[model samples]
Target: MDLSWLIPIVMTAGGVVALIALVAVLARNLKKVPPNKVLVFYGRKHTTEPRHDADGKVIEAGGTKGFQVVTGGSKWKWPILEDCQEMDMASFQMKPQLKKIPNKDGVLVNVDAVASCKIKSEQSSLSAAVERFLGKTTQEIHAMVLEILEGQLRAVIGTMTVEQLIQDRETLNTRVKAEAMSELEKLGVGIDILNIQSINDDQGYIEALGKKRTAEVVRDAAIGKAEAEAETKKRSTTAAKDADVLAANNQAMTFEADKDRDVKKATYDALIKAEQARAEQAGPMAKAEAEQKVVVQQVKVDEERERANIEVQKQKALVAAQAEEAKTVVPARKAAEALVATAEGAKKKLVIDAEGNRDAAVATAEGEQKKLVIESEGNRDAAINAATAEQKKRVLESEGARDAEINAATAQGQKLELEGKGKAASIRVIAEAEVYQAREVGKAQADAIEAKLLAEAKGILAKAEAYAKMDQRGALQLILEKLPSILEQLPAIVEAAAKPMSAIDKVVMIGSDPNAPAKFAGNVPVFLAQLFETTKNLGFDLSGALKKLGIDATAISGPDAPKVD
Candidate 1:
């Protein structure tokens, strides 16, 4: 209603237009060549004639209908009016397989090589590239340059040996570049690098040459070392002879010094023994003088000893008399001391006996009192234990009664549960049997109906075929026979309904008023109506036969009809 759907449509249109214009601008402006690349644009042919510079080189002052080469800067080329192609001014690498190139040694070698090339930035070289490799990519230009360099490498290898190619690689590079230089410049590309990466031969000639030269060098070195060793040995022999002469002269000087030292040692030993014998003679003369002085001193000592002996005899007689007097008095003194000791011992014995008697009496009384206390405590503990046992006995009896009650209840519950399970099992079995019997009877009835329908359809088909060919009478006969058989089952169906009346148990009277209509044999009329409705399911109209038989089908349908079981 607001026309809001137009907003996105208009915006998308504008955005798409802007995006297309940007893409077009990009496509045109993308033709701009950088400083490192040369762009050749010639679809419009801005140049027509070959022009020249001051050096008489064919310069391209692009104004006529011809190709023009641009080195840098943007060019506004209209769409579908001009086209531009680029040539790389930077180096490009190309590897080439150079096989079976002969060398100066007449050996065939396999060589792998690489080439680097770029477009020359000058007007003439740029013009040449526009004329030649203008639409060529970097790889295409490199492949062309590689082909030229590969030919040049083969020519250079022919002039040089394999050893020169391996050892002096820089010289090989110079020759290869010089050979390829002019040809590449004509194609408007310069050679920045030309390298021979490897060279090999199936015969291993290069390896054999290197080994031969190395062996020659090794032989020369061994010869030089052997000559130097001989010269060194000659100088060593002369030096050893001079060393022997000097050693003999030093030995003669050592022998002369040894003889002079022995003479001085012998003279010094003789002087020491003469001095020892003179000191031994002085010892005995000193000992004899000491003994003569001791004999004079002993005579003076004997005179003093005789005077001292007479004084000692007088003192000994006085001491002997004093000893006789003291010995007689000492016996009576010992006897008195013995009698004093005996009386004191008797007093101590009496004191110990009294203390022993008192301690024994106290211990007997305490023992009797402790025995009475222990007996009373034991009696008290026994009474308490007995009381606790009686209370425990009463509690156990009560718990036993409660447990008996709980067991009785549990047994009663289990019995009730088992009885309920038995009743439920019986009910489930009866219901299952009823359902099985109903299903089996229904299946048998369906099979009989289906067989009868099939036979009737076949008869109708046959009669229709017979009527279409033979007559109309044949078709009418099958209809008459099917009609009478169907009418015959209607009376039997009615009897099957009334047959359940004999099996009824009780029919209760349920009504608001006792004077109201009765419901005796109530289910029979509903069963008869259902049985009548069931006859309509067969492929026939039961009303023709029912009306001819004069049965009141309406009386079985209404609500006030008499009920029969």
Candidate 2:
């Protein structure tokens, strides 16, 4: 009776379990794809609709690795029988530090960079990324990106210089990204940011370069300052001389004007006096002649006496004029001599003082000044002689005693004027000499500074020109351009090296024979050492670079080539 009741309850529970199992199987077969991810279904033994061309011909193609990928959609798969894989479409970051990378100039540098990479958005890109990196962790993907970027960085750095790395960041970044573009595209990785965080050097080369440039700038500044100072000094000296000369000329003009007015006034006074004397003498002579005529018969002796008396008056006037002329001439001559002596004494003292204090060049300049002064004195003496001759000629041409007296006064005035003019000219000459001396002194310094600048400019310009040809891109261009020249010099280098080998008496293989593997391997380092030695004077290792490019340097050198066998 109990068994009959148990059968009904067990049958109801079994029916409920079967319903739940069917629902679970249906749910497990269905998959929902997210918007930013792809769902790949493979090994499901299913086929999509056949693709056709315009003619509707059936062209069935199998998916790669028997895999069908559906992106951003749902798919069906057997639960626990097929595998499901997922790849995140999110961005990833890769930070890497490239260390001690040698640049084009052989400078060691380091670059720390950060890059943001992601799977490309296209369906094909998703397929590629899923195939290559579907199971890889986020850290693993980042590591792969770093490895790719490091490889590209090494290649780019090999072609670039330290300056380009530091200063040409845009070009450097572009080159780095371009270098990894094809590889990343193949793997469906898109680089969003290839940012160079920092670039530095292990050596103090950059700092040293800055210091060198600074020193060069300082030297140029010092030179420019000295040149400017010299120019200013020259201008100042020239302006000073011009001012002094102008002042001397103005003073001479003033003196000459005063002398002219004084001479004119003295001549006018002398003429007035001469006219008065002529009037007074004319009346006396007429009276004497009339008396002589009247007493001609009675007193011929009286007439002679009258003539003698007129002659005596003429002689007395001449004697008085001679004494006055002598008085004026002697005093003027003595005063001129005193002034000349004083000027000579002043000149002598100045010259002696200058000689004691100044250099030999200054003394030489002073001597030139003295010569000019002496020549000027000779010119003044000639002028005086000419003035005296003019006075004598005027005296000889005189028609009367009054005219003679006027002529004498004019001559005396001319002598005074000549003396004053000579003194003023001497003073002007001395002042000009001093100005010239100072100018010469300034000019010497200017010449020295200019010469030094010119010499340094030439040397620096040559070096600058040589260095300017060494820009990273330009240097590569030059290497390509000068390849022929380098090839041409190869023969000469071989010849020189051969000369030393020819001088050597013997060569012996100590470690192993020529055909030995260890000997052959050992020769590579020896040959490299010899090559480096050969190129040491050239400032670069050409052979090493060529060998890295797969060039046979030893073969090129021929008989004189370093042994590598």
Residues 255-302 of candidate 2: C-alpha lDDT, one tens digit per residue: 777756755753454344334433443464467547644544334444
lDDT tens digits, residue span 87-127, model 1 = 77887777778778789988998888787777777776777
Native-to-model Cα distance after best TM-score fit, residue 126 in candidate 2, in Å: 2.4
Which window of 10 residues has the lowest lDDT sum in candidate 2? Answer: 394-403
Q: Which candidate number would show the highest lDDT if scored against the true structure?
A: 2
Q: Which segments of candidate 2 are over 4 A away from where they belong?
A: 5-8, 45-65, 210-565
What is residue 35's positional error in candidate 1, in angstroms?
Answer: 3.8
State residue 413's C-alpha deviation in candidate 1, in Å. Answer: 99
- Residue 26, candidate 1: C-alpha displacement in angstroms: 7.7
